[model samples]
Target: MENNMTNKLPKISEAELEIMKVLWSNSPQTANEIIEELEDTMDWKPKTIRTLINRLVQKEAVSYHQDKGRMYAYFPLVSQENYLQVETKSLLQRFCGAAFKPLLVNFLKEEKLSSEDINELKRILDEKTEENKRKDR
Candidate 1:
């Protein structure tokens, strides 16, 4: 069942992503542990947090396990990278005519990056370039 659910990606809301973040960082957290983790950062009530968790479960983005104590431990069914790929595709289609360069240029123009960040991007680009060259041969 879990394997089947993984093949279908769900559209996640920003609020739901917050709950997922908590789970992604540490799996199988109870509802209370999730609330505690986000309490300082989120200005939401316990009921609201639980509602989001419920929504995620319904969407198959999360699933619960029956622990030894008969308590339900919630864990993320969807991975963070997979969700990011969906979001990136959505953004590119919406704003950049599905073009990579325009989206990248827009981000570069808007955000200020540290030298380390720039170097890392350069390294990624260089690796991609090498892969493309190898494919051409």
Candidate 2:
């Protein structure tokens, strides 16, 4: 199912990630549309972009349907949030021995958080605590 597919997500390179970002912003884009968007920010040629698109397709991260006259519109098969969740778990496993508390502590200690950001974090923690309490009952 969807969970199994996510567990097997292909490893995406940095360059491939840039292509995914564009698709994530707006989907069902033709190759030319993707090229145009990236041309403004990236130094890569259109062919290079096309190659990256092909690679993503091969990786099953992207899927395409023929638009018109041999042209195709591509869309992401994987959601950005799902990909981020997997990547975050992998990162935690690799760096923090899969201990989430240390990672949270490190980030809270090292990174500057706005008052609003801190409040949001507190809200999320409170919600989780409440959910756990209800489950234990």
Candidate 3:
């Protein structure tokens, strides 16, 4: 599933995002390492993951180096937060009218988060709210 990679920021596919999730959690991985992680959660073959890697490289989202005997190791060029922000903004613009409240409300209604998670989100919101107030002042 190859396509153009000329977006203002490159777009990562869901499959590639899965690989990135692994990379973000523990990056600078080998292809085999990524395959092993996927094996635990997905019914995917090595080639499929390899294809995802190639796509990521083409999108400039991943960088690789050949080691002893041409073994390839990969690293994420873009950060998880950057990717998520781009995707979230795109989603908001396209479907949510660039508003996050509706999305947040939907997520809050649908998902069960831990108290710690709730508190952390609240802290983040409060921090942003405070920053915005300062800007207005």
TM-score of each: 0.80, 0.84, 0.78
* Ranking, TM-score, top scorer first: 2, 1, 3
User: Could you say which candidate leads in lDDT?
Assistant: 2
**Which sections of candidate 3 miss by over 4 Å?**
1-7
The TM-score measured for candidate 1 stands at 0.80
Task: List model 3 lDDT by residue over 18-86, tens digit each.
Answer: 988888898788999999999879889899999999999998889999888687889998877777767
Give the residue spans of candidate 2 off by over 4 A: 109-120
Which residue ranges in model 1 land beyond 4 Å of their true spot?
A: 1-7, 114-116
| Model 2 Cα shift for residue 74 (angstroms) | 0.7
By TM-score, is 1 or 2 better?
Answer: 2
lDDT by residue (tens digit), candidate 2, 77-97: 988998998899898889889
CA RMSD of all predictions: 3.3, 2.2, 4.9
